[model samples]
Target: KWRGYGVATADFGRADVTWSTQFIGKATDFNADPGDLGYRTPNVFYHNVQFAYDLFEKTRLMVGIDNLFDRKPPFIQSWTDANTDTMTYDLLGRRYYASFRHLF
Candidate 1:
């Protein structure tokens, strides 16, 4: 697994921007060669971006999206059980969310 993050704050406004990325490697799952589906797994990378602005001295609004690239998980045969192994794949593609926070 790998991860990174970056943040930017402007002196003129109460605005903040941030970016982050992460990588998940394929699993080492193994079975007897005879039961192996002959499928290979590949590493996947996910990226996210976020923006926040202060609406008031004590209130801030933030918005962001995860899995910006919308990468799909590798496909595996049914014999392996699950179509795509959740152990090594992220089925959820690009998600967006917003939130507001108040500080005392």
Candidate 2:
């Protein structure tokens, strides 16, 4: 089982500047064979990042991101006619998201 992790930090001695980063990975299994249904990768990755700071000691600002890779499993393999080449049955691409939070 493969496992990993990462972290980043930033310090603002006086003003309030902060930055952070993170990454992780795990390759725990292998398909060996797909048989029929379709081929897939046993390895998957999950990662995210968050940025935050104080606005007025009472209010705070923050942003978060998820699914940095946005990878999807392949539903089909190679073939013609009996299988046919399709732009629809393949894997998905990367996705991005942005978010903000408030405190009460």
Candidate 3:
């Protein structure tokens, strides 16, 4: 399957607008991840956005949006000896965070 892509915004003397939305089948739940739950794979839609600016010398301000669509990891399988599921969990949801860096 295939989709489409386009630009968001572009302006000088100000922050640039950049974004991307993709729906991909991404699954990762094995024995080495954060949680060890048998084998669970789920379809995921990812999104990303970034707003950057050069504040000062070696100082940069970056505001990024990850998982903007609130995409979450697939539900992990339950391995219980009681022949029933006791605990189950999934990945985090859409997160909005900011970050700053100094390349000094």
Candidate 4:
């Protein structure tokens, strides 16, 4: 499988904003054991948006949300003991974060 990202950003006054999107192309694992889920998986996409503001000459604040689409993994009922292949799929739908940084 192959994964890639798309990003865009702009600056406005004291704040800089950004938008990023990630894509995971479809893949097939022919070597998977018979007890595993399916041999193939569908493509998936995720999005994230963030904003960073200058709080001080040396300090900055940033915030963002990931998995904006809240995408769920494909269903797999035939698997041995797994509801969904969390190892090869995304389980956490959406999440958020905040951070502060200061440079000396």
Candidate 5:
């Protein structure tokens, strides 16, 4: 199982900034075989940042922070409740978000 996601954005017309990255590659646990020992499960990266402003004509505000340096999910032994591999990873390590938007 491999995944990837990278995004970068910046603007100065109404205040805007964003940075995101989430990649999870390197997995080998087909029931654990071939000299078992956790089989293999390494490679994880997660970081996110967002900021938006436009609290005026229309109203708009946003803030975000997801797993930005607080990542922990690299243990999968056929999946055991919370041992890791909770649907790909990311077990809510770091998260902070806010959003508000209006339009007429």
Candidate 6:
């Protein structure tokens, strides 16, 4: 199996934006026979984006979204939980997040 991540960021003074991608290559279920249904899973890509701004000299606020496209995980024959491979795929369709950071 192959996996990769890519990220791009742009900085504008006290603010910045970032975009990222997560890729999972197609995989075969060794436990399933070659002719069995659902023996293989298709590759998938997940997108994410974030925006950050400096709220103060020492504080920063950030907001981001995960699984921007609401990509669904591929099905695997050997794994029954959630009807997909949770370990190798994303189960959460999409999610949002916010964070604050301060330094002393």
Worst 10-residue lDDT window, candidate 3: 82-91
Q: Is candidate 2 or 4 superior in TM-score?
A: 4
Q: How does model 1 score by TM-score?
A: 0.69
Tens-digit lDDT string for candidate 2 (1-104): 44444555564532233333222222212332445544432444545555666656556665555544554533333444334224322233444444344557
Q: How many steric clashes does model 3 contain?
A: 1
TM-score of 2: 0.42
Residue-level lDDT of model 4, residues 50-81, one tens digit each, is: 99999999899999988888988765544455
lDDT of 3 by residue, 2-62 (tens): 3334446554443565787665443454443554553545454567787877687677777
Model number with the top lDDT = 6
Off by over 4 Å in 5: 1-7, 34-49, 54-62, 65-75, 78-81, 85-89, 98-104
Each candidate's lDDT (Cα)?
A: 0.71, 0.42, 0.56, 0.80, 0.87, 0.91
lDDT of 5 by residue, 1-104 (tens): 77899999999888899999989998888887855666888889998999999989799999999988998888777777987778888888998989999998
- What lDDT would candidate 3 get against the real structure? 0.56
Which 10 consecutive residues of model 1 have the lowest summed lDDT? 3-12
Cα-based TM-score, every candidate = 0.69, 0.42, 0.47, 0.73, 0.41, 0.89
- The model with the greatest TM-score is 6
Candidate 2 ranges with C-alpha deviation above 4 Å = 13-45, 73-104
Tens digits of lDDT, candidate 6, 1-104: 79999999999999999999999988888998997777888889999999999999999999999999999887778887777887777787899999999999
What is the alpha-carbon lDDT for the whole of candidate 5?
0.87
Can you rank all candidates by lDDT, best first? Answer: 6, 5, 4, 1, 3, 2
Model 1 pairs in collision:
none
